[model samples]
Target: MKKKVFCVLIYLQFCFIFPKTSFPGFRAWLSPYRMALGGSGYLSFSPLTNRNNPASLKSKKTFYSGLIRYPSSIMGQGLAITLPKKERVVGLAVQHLSYGTFDGYDSESISTEKYSSSDTWINFYSSKRSTWDDLKYGFAISWFKSSLAQNQINAIVFSLGLQLYLKSIDANLGISLNNHGKVFSNSSNSSGEMPKETVISSSKKLKYLPMKIFFDGIFNSRYKLDNINFGGEAKINNDLEFVWGTSLNKISQNTRQSFWKSFFAASGIGLAYNINSIKIFYSSFFLGTGTLYNGVSFEINVI
Candidate 1:
């Protein structure tokens, strides 16, 4: 019954929160643009092997923070870093959620009160790939904050992913186990003592069925001296995707809107360029009222 409800909520969201022309709500609003454009992207997530499922993790340009995302009204930043390596590849990333401030609504009056304090939920994660065999693994631990009510929800997440690589065409099949929602706290009153010290608690914690499995593939080609990357993937159930991206291209603005605005408002093209050891690109997400995210990253040789 709960699963049925969750599905209906997502369907209803499409009608209101996410119209055919726009998507600007909650998690969708805060999501980084690059991944968003990649088909409600879970496969493009760094440190997690589930969605960031490019089979080219062994290439020369493999270990670099290929994305930096900043959303308007969002209090935190998301970082993706790839460690330098020749044989053994390591990837690390941290997504800081909530710089602070969330409004709590009073059930009686239905009035919202913004909390003066909030906790930072960060995903500390890493991945490893080497000449070991066909098995590629990745994992991470996450600290979470309140997903709903008055500081009543908080918990930790333990995640693991396994990738099975196919020899032909360089394709990959992967599965991941994740704890989607868990809450932990002390004092059922919503103002309890620390979780470790008290017997009574107000928070929630992870329980059951928090798992996801996905498959993805990527193809690289060169056109007119420029590089073209074609990639797509699907995550478990309830998510779908299809996208087109190219490098070394620009469009002329023939209107009053700014070049960037007009370029993106009309489903503009993205630019990805590699400079020596660093990879750079202009990525943005059109979610929310529309935010422009600017990002930069460098590959560091660390073991």
Candidate 2:
């Protein structure tokens, strides 16, 4: 479909341009911005994965998510909101992506523009249940604008979910406990100095499985050290309406790299289109590094 939307618009312009000076030393987890905030495969996007598994939040009565992103040549917009909570089940999301007049001169000597950049992401989710047939366990917190500066990155996640049925077969499982507030903060560079190195990153999500066919994994570490990540994904169908997939991500041997992301292996392909109100979610059928992503998430149900 137009080359999976031009390989995720060239993967957001080759990794959303980063440089506020200090692009040296810190090869702990080769992060292409944590694999572009991950999500190229594995279950091919599950209601926007936080993994407290609500079974794709069950048919949705109201869930709004929109995006106009091209994080690389700069032009962005994002939004999200999923709700239905009294026993507590809510999701609020915000994404502003970024903007900047990109320094202008390739550096022959800039006269007016000093430099500037941006990053954003905000997410919140809640779930509570002790006795409710829907059986769920939830936790998610995100505020990551911290690539190094606009520092907002604070994360706390813990989730456990399960759903099972027999008649038509429906299964779900989710496990979490990621970034648990090991939040690192130490930024000051609007000219206040004091920040030689205070980088922080953490990860965990060994698996999230929703059956009919799909699985996901993550465990790239860094907070206290000792890391490992081995991924997985699988999907196949042709009747309930054709869809295919494959995925694999590996990083072990103390998993780490961060001079601009390393570690290999990638796979893709899982597209869905249900015409009417129009629905289109895509994939680039195996994209490892140059580009991949053309996410068109749509949902609107009023009942």
TM-scores of the models, in the given order? 0.47, 0.27
Tens-digit lDDT track for model 1 on 1-303? Answer: 343344334334433432321111112222233432332223345442222332223323344343333332333344555553555444554544332344455768575765532233455455556476776666656665543234344567555555666666344455444433345653334532211100000111113422222222322111112112222222223322223222111122123356555444313123344454443444443322233444433343333
Candidate 1, residue 94: CA error in Å?
A: 3.1
Instruction: Please give, for residues 207-252, the per-residue lDDT of candidate 2 as tens digits.
Output: 3532234444444332232222222333233211233333333232
* Local distance difference test scores for all models: 0.37, 0.37
Model 1 alpha-carbon miss at residue 147, Å: 8.1
Candidate 2: regions farther than 4 A off: 1-102, 105-110, 137-170, 173-212, 215-266, 269-285, 288-303
True-vs-predicted CA distance for residue 72, candidate 2, Å: 10
Worst 10 residues of 2 by lDDT: 24-33
- Please state the error at residue 42 of candidate 2 in Å: 8.5
Give stretches of model 1 more than 4 Å off.
1-33, 39-45, 48-72, 80-92, 99-119, 126-132, 147-152, 186-269, 287-303
Say which candidate scores most in TM-score: 1
